[model samples]
Target: MLKNIAELNVIVDKYVHWFNHERISLKTKGLSPIAYREQVLGN
Candidate 1:
């Protein structure tokens, strides 16, 4: 269980980071959303 608001915020931050930067999706052809975006944009 979350002990405090600060800890909860930290947990949320980690989850958001993972969702955007780490988690791969088959719909994205096995790339994370951010990676796919970068590839599309030529970054």
Candidate 2:
């Protein structure tokens, strides 16, 4: 149901952001992948 390439890109970007920086994982001890990575690197 995406209307155009731009809309699809926007949806992909949002999903990527959520997957990497927003959604928490129990295996990561309740941290998103990006957060876990930054924590591990002491950033």
Candidate 3:
């Protein structure tokens, strides 16, 4: 169970990076998720 949890954590981290850095969003006017989040949060 612990090993599975660790592997899941790694997968989730990779997905987070891909979503935030690589994937674009139509709702954000084609901005990457990270950029759109920053814009909305004023960061």
Candidate 4:
């Protein structure tokens, strides 16, 4: 378990980055959530 608030924040940040930038789904055409958002929004 994380022993301090800083450690917990670090872990949360890691998971958030992974979820938005590394994780992918078939519905997204194999793109990560961030990538899919950028493509759809034309950013």
Candidate 5:
């Protein structure tokens, strides 16, 4: 169970990275979600 939990955490992290950094969003002129939020919100 512990090992499975660790693996799941890693997979979740990878998906999060892909969603935030790799996928381009249309709302911010085709920038990744992370970049768009940073630009609009001021990181």
Candidate 6:
């Protein structure tokens, strides 16, 4: 469990960054979710 709000925020920030820029999956053809969406949407 998180120790405090600051710690929780750190975890949240890490996940958010990962989700947007780092995390990848085979389903998206090895791209991060946002990147794959942008590619598909032509953003």
lDDT of each: 0.98, 0.96, 0.90, 0.96, 0.89, 0.93
Per-residue lDDT of 1-43 in model 6, one digit per residue for the tens? Answer: 7789999999999989988888999999999989999999999
Predicted candidate 5 versus true structure: per-residue lDDT over 1-43, tens digit per residue: 4478889999899999999999997877999988888988989
List the candidate numbers ranked by lDDT, top first: 1, 2, 4, 6, 3, 5
RMSD of 2: 0.6
TM-score of 3: 0.59
Runs of candidate 5 with Cα error greater than 4 angstroms are: 1-3, 41-43
Report the Cα RMSD per candidate.
0.5, 0.6, 3.2, 0.8, 3.0, 1.7
Clashes of 3: 0
Q: What range of 10 consecutive residues in model 2 has the weakest lDDT sum?
A: 13-22
Clashing pairs in 3: none
Better of 1 and 2 by lDDT: 1
TM-score of each: 0.94, 0.92, 0.59, 0.88, 0.68, 0.74
Residue 19 of candidate 1: its Cα lDDT? 100
Error of 1 at 9 (Å): 0.4
Model 1, C-alpha of 24: deviation from truth (Å): 0.4
Winner by TM-score: 1
lDDT of 1 by residue, 1-43 (tens): 8899999999999999999999999999999999999999999
Cα lDDT, model 6, residue 6: 100
Which residue pairs in candidate 5 have backbone atoms (N, alpha carbon, C) closer than 3 angstroms, thus clashing?
A: none
- Tens digits of per-residue lDDT for model 3 on 1-43? 5578889999899999998898998988999988988889999
